[model samples]
Target: MNIKKGLVLGISLITLFFTTPYTPADDKREEKGEEKKVYVLDDIVVTAPAIISGNEVNRLGSQVTHVTMEQIQDLNAMDLTSALRRVPGVVISRHNQVGSFGGGEGGAIFIRGKGSSRPGAEIQTLIDGIPKFVSVWTHPIMDALNVDIVDTIDIYKGAQPVLFGNMAFGAVDVQTKRMKDTGFYTGIKSGYGSNKTHMASVEHGGKTERFDYYLLGGYRSSDGHRVNADGELQDLFLHMGYDFTAKWGMDLTLIYTDNWADDPGPIDLSYPSDGRFNNDDFFMVATISNNYERAKGYVKFYSDKGDIDWVNQEGTPGYDTLTDYKNYGIRARETITPWQKGELMMGIDLDYIRGKARFLHPVDGNSAFPEETFRIFSPYASLSHTFGSLDNIYFIPSIGVRHLNHTEFDSETAPQAGIILGIKETRLHASYGKGINYPGIYAKVQDNLWMPGDNRWSELEAENLDHFEAGVEHRFSSKLIVDLTWFYDRGEDRIVTSPPPPFPPILTNIGEYKNRGIEGSITAIPISGLSLFGGFTYLDSAPDDLPYAPEWTFSAGFNYSPVDNFQISMDTQYVDDQYVTSRARMRNTVNTDEVDSYFLVNGKISYDFRLTGCDADWQVFLAAENITDTDYEQKKGYPMPDLGFMIGFIAEFN
Candidate 1:
């Protein structure tokens, strides 16, 4: 599809979806409804970020982070990277203030040194366990993920080979909000900040009898800190659902995003700059789920399509480029409790990826590449059972495997096992899993276009990872909690350019590395309406110069309501010096120069007053970021913005 056509469709479709009538047919529908049945994990998708709560512990032996809507509001975070910055072992690289730019650190997320490679990333982005990314490129497009409808974001800190297929080395799950109350509601919020930054969003949602729906639309823009750095995002999300019966229901979801950001080249580096990276992404998901006393399951079908336009590449052959891609899949899982304290889960996944790219102005004057496609069918299952003494002591041991059936490559079965020991409110867990990422068509595009004549991409193999993790959490009291964890990953068979090429450009799977780290966090509610949370991480990576892997990081924050209708929140963080690398074709080399360590502080304060005649309130808020005015860089030579602030207001009513 043409880039212009895709952009038009994205904008027009979003408008149409958001304009759907709010009122349901048959206005007199019965209001009586049965209590909702608890759905299994296989059916209920979720999202959160930073410091998972003790009460949310159910993953047995995995490390997870949780951040809620209230916390996101407190942080005044506008995107995934900002919202998740405080997550342990997490790092992000971005060149602009607003949207995520193109490849090469323009927009990227990393976890313990993984996911740094664009077009072949290990970290996966998901919405309700459904995979969402650049199908042809094989990595996530950050701009495509719209945060306007997010209720929470959950970060699973390591490989989840059994539960999630493909790019499961690490994962981010975004859980959209669902209406709970029986009355219709509306919300509006807008803000203006430093660098001509402005944003506005509105939403409507409600639950009625056997029907429920949520709809949202938003826009954000900024004149960034540097020339050609401006960016903007427009998005819409809608969800409609109806209960077929007390135990079964169905939901249809639509999400669309059109966003673009420009790259402001490094100050110290002299290179031809790529001016802008634009994207139009859309997604549709349909789900049918059921719940019963001993069994729960779901079947989901999803399609995600996107068009990326590389507006400029000043000196490269591909001066202007466009790539169109789509990903579609069907997944289903059944979770059953065959006997008391015992659970079994079985599931299957089928995925198809395809796309094509064209250079509007190739320096070589040749701009055609045939479209390609890849297919994979994965089936997995796991079982867990609890064992323990009469009281206060018990452990759940689990095991599972996923067989990858790829149409273009040999298959690999990912195996995972774990054990979780619980002593009352304190729990200890350990787990190990294997992860695999097939060499998608992205690799093919690279070799066929850049290799001139020697295309070794056809011989390239899949990358593999062996991961192990262990942790312990102790809840001293309902008001205080602490958790700590350590992990090690062995990565091998990674596809890479034949190093320091002198004559031939060859891609091989000889790359290998080991990464280990320990991270811990604590959350405390010292007094009524006051929350305090802190976390720290230490990493040791061999081939030690891993890109974006910092040695030490720390974060702490507090939210307090000192008086009625008034609130205050403050957060601070520190990042260690780290190397910046590049993954452009044969230029895949780690930069020796390290970006220096830096400290940052951010805070927000708000006050709310009820509207006189309606069940609504308007909240005015003030937020400040980089309060220390520290000069730092996330990507080498890309200096961050100075201290700045924003003023905003939010209103809601039923």
Candidate 2:
């Protein structure tokens, strides 16, 4: 079918299917006649960077999706990465090799088919309001670890609240569980999955009259399916809170993560596509946060660092490398209510980041690519006003500016405006925002440092984007909630690496490019004990296609609990044609064809039980991924494996 025809038919089919009701699952219940009772919608979706507590499923918002703790646990997910797969419009790429012990190339994620291929640094990850960077390009430090201590994960598919940090090309916020009021509590869990994958974790937390604390430790290992691809991971998490009084409080958190395994480098399936390599990365972070409700303000200070060791490069010793990074920041924010239905939020944020890389001979270590450091000072604010319940109208306007001291780059500003109109059970919204991205260490090193004739380094401007979106959400009943959104984005002056010429263009400082696109998603739970979620995205870039960005992508799934404590779930996604690399000359070549679309399946079952002195539960989970055993690559030439499974248990003590 032609592109236009396909698009029309796709929308018609989806709309028709949703309009027709299905049999309600007996397990579905209503709260005060509200259909969205199973999950609280308002508490679920994070409207802005400011942290708000409540049930997300019931939260009234636009272009947002939330995954609750119960939803994560019921699936018996192997990691936080997999736990987000069920979220509509979100695409998660996983390593397919059975023996592949470490999480590597094939593992990644994309939101609305944007920023997925770029190093993960562009995608913002917030842990309890603190901005987090995952080893520059890879997944978060906690991606491979267990989620035993997590409370919930909220995804804002577009520009989010101004306080979280201006880095989110596509926003993701992760919130960890906190210590309860109970005197003391502890829990432990163990599980076994396919490929000899075993996992275990211990978590405990308690609250004293003046202080509260929580700690979690976990370990996971596997004898991977690939010949040399086996590895292990260890994780540690700690959180503590102190209440000086009813209006003053402080919270602190520390995290340590480590992963090591044979790389199992990419395969050239057409040639000799099998080889073993080594991959190891370790990360750590420390943060402290203080809040004063009476003063209507808060502040935070934190630092993050990491190192990577890649044993096998395509063919060079300089290919072997270790990198270090340090980030320090301080932010102060406050909220004020000038009128009954109007409020203002303002903040000042300052951050300094520095890093260095050491590589072998072929890396040209003698070049002028010295260690680098940069600082950003940003101050921003927003004013929002809400009408009465009858009108249910909300209008918000905001702006943020970043000043970069190094590279002699001038400052840049981003502005945003959004409005929401609620009419009984239906709500409509429209928003426009801007985003800016500065060059990272890798960009500077490859472009300006090595290129002999490229004098445009200092002249390169930070990439910028103008985003616009409009959508509507309707509540047909308590059990049936649906949302549809349309977005158009224009990218301007995007820094891109130019190809090498007679003098070999520098690696870091590239020229520029542009991109534009449309995207949307649908989330619904038509019946009790069952939920159906799906989403599709369409994108057209200036260069025909963007790397790792499928022109069209989608996911559909359902979850059911036939009996108490026993649940079953399945989900699948279709990613249309996508480019593995950014080279325009080879964009349509057969080499990139390996990363075609495929289907994946997951399932599980858990039983609740108790022993004297122990509140325990046993869950047996079986996840059959790539059920057809189709050999496909989510990343170029990186052959992913087929058909795999896992099983696990949990016990709590007082």
Best by lDDT: 1
Residue 261 Cα positional deviation in candidate 2, in Å, after optimal superposition: 4.0
Tens digit of per-residue lDDT, candidate 2, span 1-654: 012323323433443333212221121111110122332333323111111111231122235566656666655665666676545555565553222222334444556545543432345666655665533333343343335546766676654435444555666766776654535555567777667877777666666677877767666667776644565655667777777876667777776656555545456444332223233222233333343432366677767665544443554444455555566677777766777766677787776666666555465543334557767777777776667563354443333333333334667777666777767777777776666666555555555444467635566666566667777777676445556667766655655545545454433333233444455444554445555555556655554545555667666666666666665666666767676543231112222433677665555555556555433334455556656676666666556555776666665544
List ranges where model 1 is wrong by over 4 Å.
1-57, 315-318, 389-391, 499-504, 583-588
What's each prediction's TM-score? 0.91, 0.80
Off by over 4 Å in 2: 1-62, 94-105, 116-121, 134-149, 164-166, 269-295, 315-319, 361-369, 390-408, 447-449, 453-455, 499-527, 582-594
TM-score of model 1 (CA atoms) = 0.91
Please give the lDDT score for candidate 2.
0.54
Q: What overall lDDT goes with each candidate model?
A: 0.78, 0.54
Per-residue lDDT of 378-403 in model 1, one digit per residue for the tens?
Answer: 99999989887525899889999999
lDDT score, residue 32, model 2?
A: 10
Q: What clash pairs does model 1 have?
A: 47-152, 47-153, 47-154, 48-153, 48-154, 49-66, 49-67, 49-153, 317-363
